[model samples]
Target: MSKRTAILQTAAANTDAATEALDLALAMASMDQSVQLILASEAVNCISDNPSKRYAMLELLEAEPILVFTDEPLSNPHQLDIEIISSQQLAPQLNSYNEVLQFS
Candidate 1:
């Protein structure tokens, strides 16, 4: 009865795709599932401090726990309340989840 799921987003160039992925994750969370979103690579840029192009996705992330990979520097690191972790930490953490969705 494990409802653990991981949503991995790595495409920073497409905001639409990132928003769609966040919406899907929100839907799952609404169903009482434990969901975690991982923003890595260019995808970390999907979050911004200001209410700009990625505002919608940023809003959704506030509802859930998000992990941002620190391999690269983010455009606005102070914008979102994200857990910054390294690539080495990502694999072990991901393995703990029962399911994973990649939106890249």
Candidate 2:
């Protein structure tokens, strides 16, 4: 059987929501699921200079693939070491995935 791929889109505006989104993604990844996390719009703010949040996300990145859409430039001072894909690439990327989950 083919591995199931999942894309998790997050537009969380606050820390709590962002944390919850991260938790969900972690859970999915822990189950040996192919999970991709996309940070868009305000969701990019979740990876600010804050150590705890950044570290949490870094842990998740170690477990699964994390991506950011180029259309939404990150507003945070801290940069996340993840792949940045263009809007044009979004459709094709999603096409390769079996499921897409959005958390706003």
Best by lDDT: 1
After aligning candidate 1 to the native by TM-score, how far in Å is the CA of 90 from where it should be? Answer: 1.0
- The clash count of every prediction, one per candidate, is 0, 0
Where model 2 places Cα greater than 4 Å from the true spot, the runs are 13-17, 48-61, 72-79
Per-residue lDDT of 1-104 in model 1, one digit per residue for the tens?
76788999887745777777777777776666778778877777666434234334444544455788877655664465567789889899889899989988
Q: Please, what is the whole-model Cα lDDT of each candidate in the order they appear?
A: 0.71, 0.62
* Root-mean-square deviation per candidate: 3.3, 3.2
Q: What clash pairs does model 2 have?
A: none
Model 1 clash pairs?
A: none
lDDT of 1: 0.71
Please name the candidate that would achieve the greatest TM-score relative to the true structure: 1
